[model samples]
Target: MLFGAKNSSNPRLQLLKDVVLFKDLSMRELAMVDSLMHERRYLADEIIFDEGEEGQGLFVVLSGRVKIARFASPLEMLIELGPGAFFGEVALLDQSVRSAQARALEDVQIAVLFRAEFYSLLETHSAIASRISFQLARVLAARLRQAVANTDRHHEAA
Candidate 1:
């Protein structure tokens, strides 16, 4: 199979199911999303995407770990994500510059859902697109709330 056989046991399909963006998708829907995705392997310390680069799309860690970092004066490391975690979701909405860079902490396998491919899927499957878009919004909202809470705590501590 060109994109891996469409079977219940397909690891890629399972990985897609575990991601927040595709969590609501059924097995059949996962297969459709899988079709739009391409796999890439990166070695430890390899850059996946750099901050300020044009955002490509969402990247899900299929295996190993990925580090999301902000390259400021001190180079702050933001988060380390393992299998099934996803990043660069903002690119799905528009091809803006990335705010952070992603690197492989170890040899990693990633599934990339490119913007053009996602748009094509949206046109062909609006229902699926709507579901994913809504989920993305919810995820962002939750993160925003957490950020606000942290800011409030920081202010109180000062």
Candidate 2:
């Protein structure tokens, strides 16, 4: 569980400008997104989400840092994202279990978009939805390439 203050004045729209995923969205489009998402805050070292848990939505970092990690023999870090970055996008396409766990490195703020609400937004606003879809696809493609490269490195070492 988590709790914090909510900023009602254009915080979401400003966040849209920070996130590359929403770089193409206009002020009006961002405002629409603002209306659809909810904001939350987490204390430092908080586990935002756990790996293998069902993903319910996407999250945009509004402030502070988050580390994405996976557990095997030991915990392996995937990445650390700061303000302006976003994650959990895979849930938007499919309600798949989360691949990595996210922990806040500092007291953090994030805007969350729930799956049901996002789907409704898509149905109501086709253009913004298309842009988000394209952005997610590109991000996934890049991650896949990185994964393949990492696999090759591990194979060569063995």
TM-scores vs. true structure, each candidate: 0.93, 0.88
Candidate 1 per-residue C-alpha lDDT over 41-105 given as tens digits, one digit per residue, 9 for 90 to 100: 99999999999999979999999999999998899999999998899999998879999999999
lDDT agreement with native, every candidate: 0.91, 0.87
Clashing pairs in 1: none
lDDT of 2: 0.87
Sliding window of 10 residues with minimal summed lDDT for model 1: 1-10
- Candidate 2 minimal-lDDT segment of 10 residues: 1-10
How many pairs of residues collide in each model? 0, 0
Error of model 2, residue 91, in angstroms = 0.8
lDDT of 1: 0.91
Q: How close is each model in CA RMSD to the real structure?
A: 1.6, 3.8
lDDT of 2 at 41: 99
